[model samples]
Target: MKKQHSRPNILVVNDDGITAPGIKNLIEAVKELGNVVVVAPDGPQSGMGHAITIGKPMRFNKVDLYEGVEMYKCSGTPVDCVKLAVNKIFKGKKPDLCVSGINHGLNNSINVIYSGTMSAAVEGAIEGIPSIGFSLDDYAEEADFSHCLKYVKSIAQQVLDNGLPQATLLNVNFPKGNGIKGIKICRQANAKWAEEFDERQDPYGRPYYWLTGVFQNNDKGEDTDVWALDHGYVSVVPVQFDLTAHHAIPLLNSWTFND
Candidate 1:
């Protein structure tokens, strides 16, 4: 059992900007669990999967938004926020836990690969901190996150009590509204976004394209995150930053490569 400090240092971050309602609710959920320090984008950085700022400087500013909460808004991607929190804010002294998001939309299945919310959690995992990313299925500006406060707090508390496996982080997605069945520990379903670029002319007569897609899931596993979410269960998929396909190594070993 992992014994957290009486006042654990919990770093809270999100891709939905500092002012988003999602982040506010997220802070409320876990603020009592420890010392909550927030560092997030100044504006929405959704879908910016694991991206980091390069070739340019970013602006970071401190603000007093939520009373009694230490928060900052960064002019960078979600991953950059975690990087800044781990390196600058925490001053290399790792936080006891890192929680990202209460994202405006779901990030289950293949969506995790392209989610700034989950990417922020992934960055925390990379920094050797226990992390989890939370999201809701709704995209409305006024989406209510009240129904999830209990579950969020419980999950964070559990993580505080029991640390996650090495290098593993959680990708948690909740369905919109009340009547949540329960929590389901599951795997990421084999899924993808069938994307296309819709082209149109701007007011200045310049052609631009908008990226859009339909989520495709063919995996029939009942234990997958998609199935859990579709059934009103909060899906918790343990994810890792290691992209190694160790199982394929043996198959590739049979093939000889010319040096």
Candidate 2:
């Protein structure tokens, strides 16, 4: 059994800015488990993925958002928020755990590849912190989070009690309704975004393209994240940052190299 710290230092981050209700509820869920420190984006950064702010200066300011919680708003991307928290705020002392999101919308299946919420958790895992990103399927600004609180607390506590494997983080997505069946540990669905660009004229008469896409899930496996989410169950997918295709190495070695 993993030993528990009396009060773990928990780093909380998100992509939906500091004032979003999603982050507020997330902080409330995990605050009792540790000393909560929030370092989040100042504005919405939903589809930023793993982007960091470069070619420009980044800034942070202390805020009085959540009472008794140390909070800061960063003028950068979600990943930048994590970097700043580790280097500037924590001063190289790694937090016991990191939790991202309670995001306003879903981050399951291929959506995880484009989600800033999950990217922050990925950054935390890369920094050797046990991390999890939570998201709800609802996209409304006033979506209710009450249904997800218990599960969020349980999952966070579980991670605190049992550290995750190296370079791995969890992408957890909750169904929008209150009648959620339960949690399901599942693999990422074989999915892609069917994309198209909508071209329209700007006010200045210049053509502007708006990117839009439909989520396409081709995997028929019942053990996939998408299936779990669709069946009123919360999906928890163990995500790894290592993008290497290790199985392809042996096939590549069989090719002849011309000198």
Model 1 lDDT vs. the true structure? Answer: 0.94
Model 1 Cα lDDT, one tens digit per residue, 1-259: 4778678999999998999999999999999999999999999999899899997999998899999999999999999999999888999999989998899999999899889999999999999999999999999879999998999999999999898999999999999899999999999999998999999999999999999988899999999999999999999999998999999999999998897
Ten-residue stretch with the least lDDT total in model 1: 1-10
lDDT per residue as tens, model 2, 175-244: 9988999999999999999999999999999999999888888899999999999999999999999999
Colliding pairs, model 2: none
What's the lDDT of the predicted structure labeled candidate 2? Answer: 0.94
Cα error, candidate 2, residue 226 (Å): 0.4
- For model 2, the superposed segments whose C-alpha errors exceed 4 Å read none
